[model samples]
Target chain A: MSDHAVSRRAFLRAGGAVLTGTLASTSGVLALIAPSTSWALELEALDAHQGATVLQFTRHVFPHDRLDDAVYALVVKDLDAGAAEDPTTRRMLIDAVRRLDEASGGEWLSRSAAEQFVQVQAMEATPFFVKVHSTAVVSLYDNDMAFAHFGYPGRKGDPGYIHRGFNDLHWLPDPPDGASGPVPETA
Target chain B: MDMYDNRTTFAADDDGVVVVIGSGAGGGTLANELAQKGVDVVLLEAGGLHTTDEFIADEWPSFSQLAWTDTRTTMGDWRVARDFPNLPAWICKAVGGTTVHWAGASLRIEPHEFRARSTYGDLAGATLRDWPLSADDLASYYDTAEKKLNVTRTNGLPGLPANNNFKVMHAGATRLGYETCHTGRMAINSVNKDGRNHCMQRGFCFQGCRYAAKWSTLYTEIPAALQTGRVELRTRVHVARIDHDDNDRVTGVVYFDADGRERRQAARVAAVAGNSIETPRLLLNSESSRFPNGLANGSDQVGRNYMRHTTGTVWGVFDKPVEMYKGTTMAGIVQDEARHDPKRGFVGGYEMETISLGLPFMAAFFNPGGWGRGFTEAMEQYRHMAGMWLVGEDMPQADNRVTLSSEARDAFGLPVANVHYTDHANDVAMREHAYTRGAAIYEAAGATRTYRTPPYPSTHNLGTCRMSERAADGVCNGHGQSHELANLFISDGSQFTTSAAENPTLTIVTLAIRQADYIAERMRARAI
Candidate 1:
C-alpha cells in the first residue's frame, strides 16, 4: 500500500510489533508484559503499576475520544525512560502515584473514571503533574497514531500539494477572482 | 560561470576588513551589498550553518533545533513573561538568523509611522521619537529591497494562491465591510525566479522552507556575498565585545570561536545585527574606562525603548473541516485595520494575518497552562479550526528594555540578557481592539466557538537601539552610524525609531541596503 493509505489500525498494529522488538533491544534494562489485550508496555525504571497510572494520567490531560490507549502509552514510554535516567524523576513518579491513591481513598485504580479525574485535577498544580503533562502534550500528539486519529495530515509534502488538493476546500463559497486588489507598483 | 563560492576564510588579524556581526536580513544583505561593491568583509555569525536541505519538517523537533535556546529571563506584567518566562523571543539561532523562521510577510512601514512623535503628539507616559530620516529617504531602497527579495504583488510577480485559511479570513473581512484583504505581499516566490524554486504550498514555512522558495539570507545573499570572493563567512563564532581605540572608534571585535578559544579580529568598522536583545547586551558588556558607560551609550539609550508588536492569536472552531494547516503557515492578510484611527479607542494600527500552528505547538500554546475538558474539546476541533494572528504597533517605552542579567550567565561566562517589559496603556488598548476584531472576523465566518489566546514569545523584536535626529536623543543617526563612534553601526530592526504596523523583515533589509551604500561612500571619501 502507499504510505498515505496506511490506516490508523494498521499504524497501531505496527506499533505493537515495534514494542516487541524494543523488548529484545532493552533485554537487561527493560521488562515487557501485556497487562491487557489492547496494549503492551516495555518499561525500564517504572514498574507495571506506575507505567499504567502515567498512561491513565496522560489520557485525562489530553482525552481524545478516537485515540487508542496504545497512543497514550507513548507518554508512558518516554516518562519511563526519563525515570530510568534520573533518580529524581523516578521518585517524583512514585510519589505522584502515592498521592493519587491517597486522594482517591487508597484505591485509585478501583475508582470510576470520574473519581480518577477529580484526583488528577486536585494535583494539577503539583510539579509532577506539570512535568508529565508538558512531556505528554508533545510526546502523545506528535506520533503517527495520534496524527491519524486527529486527522492531521503528516509532514509528507516534499514536492508538495500544489497539484494535489490545495484549493479543494469546496465547503466555503468561492471568493471573487479579483478579490486580490491591484498590485501597487512598488519597484 | 561560478554561481556561488562555499569556501572563504579571513585571517584574525586582518585590520582592513569590515566586520559585520549576525547574518539575518540586515547583516547578510549589508555584507553582500558591500562585497558586490568589491569591499572586503568578514561576516561573523553565532549560530551554525543549516542549508535548506538540512531543514526539518516536524514542528517540535525543528523548533528545538532552530530556535535560539540560549539563557534569557523575562519579567513584566505581559502574559508572555508568565507563559514563557525563559524564552522571551522566538527568533532563530541558525546562520540566516530569524529570516529562516520568518513568515515571509514583507511590508513597508507606513509614512506616518516615520514621524510618530509628531503624529501622535505626547502620550502621557511614552517617550516616542521621530525617525531621523523620512519615508522619502528610504523609498528607493524599499523598492530595491522588494525586488531583491522578489516580494510578490510587486515587480510584476503574482501573489500566492489563496488557501482555505485565507478564504475564511476573506469571507469574514468582506462581510464586516472591510476592504484590502488578500493573499499577502509574501517574500516567498509565486513562480520560478532568480534560480530558486517556487513555493509548493508545503505548509511548513517556520521550519525553514526546504525548497528555498522563501527568501532567507542563508540561501540567497550569504552565498552571493561569498561568490564575489570579497567576504569570509564564519559560523559558530560568538562575538563577546566590540573593542575600540583611544579615540573611541570601534577598531576590532573580541570573540570566542567554535573551540571556545578567545580570539580577536581587527576591523576597520563593526556593524552589530544580533537582533534587538543580544545587540544591546553586546554593547553593554563591552564597557571600558574610555567609554565607561558602554560604547556609544553616552545618552543611555542603547538598551532602552524596546518594542515587540502587540500580538495575539484568535482561533475559530467551525462545524466543517477547514484543514487550516494545508498551505503556507502565513499566506493571507487584512490591511483595512492597519491605519492610525484614534477612534478605535487606541492610537496606531494593527494587521490581521492568517496563521496556523501544527498540532504540537497548538497544544502547547493554545492555553499555555490549561487542561481539563474545555481545553481538550477545543483541541479536538483541530481539523475544523481556522486561525489568525493580530499584530499591532506597540508603543516604545524606555523601561521596556533589555539589560544584562546580574545572576544568569551564558556558556561564554557573560551575563545573559534580562528582558523587562510591560504593556504601555496604549499597547493594552490596541491588543484589546485587535483581539475583539479578530474574533469577530472568525465569528462572521460561521465559527461555532472562538478561542482567544495570549501572545506567545515575540517574533518582531525591534527598537532597543533607536535612531534620532539629535545625538543626545538616540544611539544612531539616520544612516545607522553610532553618534559617539563613527565606525560602529546598528544594522538591524533594533534601529527602528517606531514600531510600525508592518512585518519588519522588508524594512530591515531596506535599511541594510541603505547602510551598505552609506558605508561604501564613506570608505571612498576616506572617512570612518
Candidate 2:
C-alpha cells in the first residue's frame, strides 16, 4: 500500500478511540500482555491506586490525547532500555511525580481544572516540575529529529516574514489619530 | 538580602550617546552597527557573562540560564506544552539573548510571512497585520546579516541525508500538493565564512558555541561593538526605567548592577532592544507622570498583542539509527507549508524543522513510558525516535496580551510580566491542520507510532509592542520608534506586526540593522 494509505488507516484507527470502550472490550490479560508495558517494576513507580498517577497510568495503558503520559512513560522506558543505567534519574522521576501528587494533597484527578492549573504552576517552581516540562519539550524535539531523519517537509522556510500579503500590505493606513510620527519608509 | 544590591551610579561628564537596553542579538547588532559609525553607546543587559564553563550538561541549570528566568511565566492551554509549569516560552536575558543558546536555525521570512494579515483578513479574535517593511526591503538586510552572522549552513551537501523520515515528508508534501516548495534555508554555516569554521555537527549549539561556528551576539556583534570602543556593555545590569522629560523623549535610564544597587546614565536616545516579552515589560514597568501610562505608552499598547506562532509537531518511531543528535541542533527544515493557506482555515502557515535529540541523561527523563527493562528496550529504539514541528503563524490579539501584574513582583521588585492569552480558535485550527499534515508525513516515513501536539511555549514570542502605521494602532510605528517618544525606538520582536511562522532571530537582527539606519539618519538630521 502507498505510505499515505497506511498512515490514513492508522490515524483513523487512532481516532474514535474511546478509552472506556477499549477497557471494556479488552480483557486484563490482553492489557497485561501489551508490548511496551510487560515489565512489573515499570508499573510500580507510583502507588498505582493513588490519584492522578492512576489516571495517568491508565491513560498510558492505551495511548490517546494526553501526550505527557506517553512521553513520560517512554522516557523512563528509554533510560532503562540501554545497558548503562542511571538509578538516580529513575528515583528523581518517581519522587518528583509523587511529591507533586502529595503536595497537592492527592486532589489531582478530582480537583477543579482551575485548581489543577494553580497546583501545576506552583509545582513548576520546583526543579522536578521544570524537569518534567523540559523533558516533554525535549522529547517532542527528538520526535521532530526523527521526522527529519526520514526527511520531512514543513521545517523549511525563513525565520521571519511568513506573510502572504507581505507585498500588498501597501495599504498602510495613515498613523492612528493622524499623527504621522517618523515611519521613515525604506523605499 | 537580594542580589545586585551593590549597584552604584557612574556619572560620566560626557553626556552625548544612544543607550541600547538588553544587549542580545537585536541590541548587540544595533549597538555594533551604530558604534561602527562612531556613535557612543551604553548597552544594558540583565544576565552576565556566563562562560561556557558555567553550562552543565543538564537542562535545568542550562535552561534557567538560557531560558527566561522570570518566575511569573505560564503556558495557557497550549495542549502538550501545557505540561510546562511555566511558559515553554524560552528567551534569554543574556548577552546574546536566546541566540546565546539557540539551535542556530536562522532562516529568512519567505516573501509570504511579512503580510499574512492582508492575505487572510482579520483572523477571528486575533489581530494579524502587514508589516510596514517588505521581504524585498529586508532582502539586502538579510544578506548583510548573513555575511555578518555567517548564515551559511546548506552548502550543497544535503542536510540530513534522505532517511526514511525525509522520504515520508517528501511523499506527504507531494501528496498534499506542496511540490513547488522544498526544504528550509538556515543560518547554520554549511561552509566556513568570514574566518568562522563550518559547524562541527556537535549537536550542542544551544549550549553556547565555542568554535564560533554558531552566530550569536556573544560571538559576533558584541565583539564588533566593543571593537569600535564606542559601546560600553554593562553585564548583569537590570534596567529599571527609561527616564523621560516633560516632552516624553527618553533622557536617560536607571538600572541596578548585578549586585543590585541603583545607577543611572544619561542618553541622547534610547533603544529598547530586549526581545518581544521583556522589552514591553520594561516599558510598562516604567511609569511617570510625564508619560503617565508608562514611558512611550500613550495609547496603552506597550504590552498588547503578545503572540507565539501556534507550533505543531508530529512524532513517530523509525526502524534505523538516524543519528539525528549528531549535528547542529537544527540542520534541516521543511518550507512547503511556509505561506498562508486560505483553504487551510487560518491566515498562517508553518515551518517544519528537523530538531536534534538530547544526550543520554536528558533523553532518559524524556522518553515515553514503559520502565526498567521495558524502558531499556526503548533506549535501544532511541536511535529510531523521529519527529518534526511546524511553527504556524499566530495572530496578534489585543486582549491576549502581557501586563505587569500588580500583585506579582520579580526578584528586582519590578512587577512581573503576566501573560493573558488563550489560543484563538484560528490558531488552534491551524495547529490541528499543521499537525495533520505533519502526521501524514510521519506515516509516509513508515511511522509505527504517531501523534500531534499543540505547542505551548517555545521562544519566538512577538507582537506585544506590535508595529502599525498609526501610533494609537500600535505601541511603536513602522520604524519601531515609540509613537509617543520621538527619541525612543525598539529593535526587538515586540515591534512585530504579526508573529511569522519562522523563528524570529534573523528578523529581529534585520530590523535592528534597518532601525540603526533609520535612527542614524534621524540623528544626522538633528545632529545629535
Candidate 3:
C-alpha cells in the first residue's frame, strides 16, 4: 500500500529478529525483546497472507494510529495462536472484522488491500474488536519515546509507565490533500 | 503492567508518613490532605502524565496519549487474558486516570441510592442494596470537594448559543414534566482558581484540556499535593502484588521497575486504589502461603460485585446548530429519575446529561445510520447532531465480576483483569426507558433526525470490592479497609457500595479523604 512504510517481509524479518533479541529497538516504540523461538515460530505461522490481511485490517480499524513492525509482532503473535486464552475477546475481534468486511460486500481476508483497509473498522463497536483496534490504533498515531515499545502513546521518561523513552516519532497519514476516497452517505 | 515493576510500593528512601495509590481524584486529594496535615505522603501512579503540548488536535491521538491506556489489551481472568468476546469497556490508565477525558459533571448521590436494598431489595441475580454510608455523611465532603475542584453550576450562563440539539432536549424534558435542569457541578474553572485558567468552551475535555480548565488530578489535587514536597510521585512502576509478613501484615509492595526490573519496597501499610479491576487483581496476585486465598482475600470476596454506570445515549439532528462540543464536558444532569425504579423492573437508576461531540467521530458514528455519503450528509449538518446520555444503574451480579486471567499476560508477566458483565434484566429495561425518553426529548426540541445508543459498557467502572461490616459480606469495610487485614485499605471507586447516578470522581475523593483520616489515626496508634 502507498501509505505503508516497510514491506511485510521486511517487517517480519525485523520483528522476528527483535523478538529473538538478535535485534534491538525495531521502530523504537517498545524495546520488548520477546522470546526468540516464540517469534520465529510466529513468523513461520503468518507467512505472507496473514501479514497482508493484518495491514489491510489495520488501515480501517486504526487509520489514525501507527502499525509499525513492533505492533505487528505483538498483534500477529496473538492472532496466530487463535486467542484461545482470551476466547471471548478473540471471538469479538474476529466477528467485528468479519462484520466489517461483510458490510463492504467482501471478505476482509480476501478483498483487495485497499478495499479491506477502508471498511475494516466498520464493526468497531464490538467490544473485543475495539480493544484489538485500540492496541494498534494508539500505537500508530501516539508520538513518544517510551510509546515506541509496543507503539503505545505518551512520551517516555514520563516517570509513569514501564518503558522510559522512544523515538518520539509521529505516524499520522497525510490529510485528504485533494487525492482521496469518496465521502460516504450520511447515516 | 507486570508485578515486579509495580509502583504501588511508593515507599522510597523518602517514604512519606502517608502514601496514596493512584493519582486520580481519590488519591490526589487524599495525598494533598495528608500533606497539608503535615504528613509526608507519596502519590504512586500506574499511568504517566500527558503534557499540555501532546494534547494537539486529533481525538484519537489525544485519547491515546492523554486519555487512558494506549494498549486496548486487558488482563485476563487469573494469569490469562480472555479478552472478553464482544464487550468493550474503556478505563484510563494514566496519572489523571479516567478524569483526563471525563465529562466533568458531578452529582450528589440521592439519599435512596445509599440503600438500594432497602428500596429495591428484591432484584434478581444481585446484591443490590444501600451504601454502608449515606449521602448526608458525604454532604460536607461533596461541598468541600466541589470547592477544591472549582466546580461551577451551569443553570444559567450567558448566551450559551443553544443549537437545535439543546432545544430538542429542553423541549422534551419540559414536555415530559421532568425536573430537567441544566447539568451542574462541573470541575471546569468558570473563572480562574489558583493558577489554572477557566474552561474555554472548546468541547475537548476528554482530549486533555489544553488550558487546564478541567479538574483532572494533573491540574488539581496532584499539583497541590506535589506542592507540599512531602509528596513524591513515582509513575510507570507497575505493581504486581502487596508483600506481607507471616502474621498477615502488609510490609510493602512488589513490582516490576520501568526497565523491567523486579523490585520491592517496604511499607507499614498498603492501600488498593487501582480501580475495580486492578485493585482486586492486585490483592489476588499478592498471594502467599500465609494468605492463601490471596492477600486480605480470606473471605474470598476480594474481586466481586463489579458495576458499571447503567448508561444509554440518545443522538439527534436539529434544524439549527447546537454547538454541543463548545462548552464544559457536562453542562447539567437530570436527577428526578435517579432512584431504583423497581416498577420499571430494574435494579439501578439513571442520570441524564448533555454531552459534547466533535464532527469527526461522533458525527461519523451516530450519523443516523449507514456508511459513505449518508455519513457525510450527517456531517454536513453537524449543528443538527446532538447526543445525550441516560446513565442508568447496573445491579451487582456475582457472575459479573473482575478476576485475574490464567492463560494470558501483558508484556510484563502479570495477570490481567478479566471482567465478566452481562446486562441484567433491570438494567436492560432502564436502558430502553432512557432511550425512549431521550427520543421524546429530541422530538419535543424539534430534531429532524434522532437515534439512541443502548446499554454500552461505560468507562466509569465501580463496585468490584464492595464494603460491608463483615468480611464474609464484603471485600472491604465502611472505611474501605480490607475485612481481614486491618492494615490494608482501598482508595478508589472499587469500594463503591452502590452505583449512584453521577460521575464518581467526587464520591471517590470524599471516600479517599475519609480513608486517609482513618489511616492517620491508625498511624498515630502505630497500628499500621
Best by TM-score: 1
Which ten contiguous residues of candidate 1 chain B have the minimum total lDDT? B1-10
Per-prediction TM-score, chain B alone: 0.99, 0.89, 0.89
User: Candidate 2 — which residues are off by over 4 angstroms?
Assistant: A1-187, B1-13, B52-58, B79-82, B153-183, B359-381
The CA lDDT of each predicted structure is 0.86, 0.61, 0.60
Model 2, B1-528: lDDT tens per residue? 212221222254345788899877789889889987777888788887765445544344566667666766553554423444445466786777777777666678777777767777765676767787789988888878766765543333222223223334454455555553233345555455556655544456666665566787876787777766677778888888888888667788889888888888898898997777778888888888777777778888888888877776566666544444444455445676777667877676777775544543323233332222333334444556555767867777788777787776877799877776678888877878777877776666566766443453557778888788777778888778888888888888888888887788888888899889888988889934
Candidate 3: misplaced stretches above 4 Å? A1-187, B1-17, B70-87, B154-168, B363-381, B455-457
TM-score of each: 0.93, 0.71, 0.71
Per-residue lDDT over B195-300 for candidate 3, one digit per residue giving the tens place of the 0 to 100 score = 8765555556667777776777776666666665666677777887887677767777777767878776666667778777778888888888988877877777
Candidate order, TM-score descending: 1, 3, 2
What are the per-model C-alpha RMSD values against the true structure? 6.8, 15.1, 12.8
User: Residue B7 error for model 3, in Å?
Assistant: 18
CAPRI grade of model 1 = acceptable
Pick by lDDT: 1 or 2, better one: 1
Task: Tell how far residue B279 is off in model 3, in angstroms.
Answer: 1.2
Candidate 3 chain A, poorest ten consecutive residues by summed lDDT: A160-169
- Top-DockQ candidate index: 1
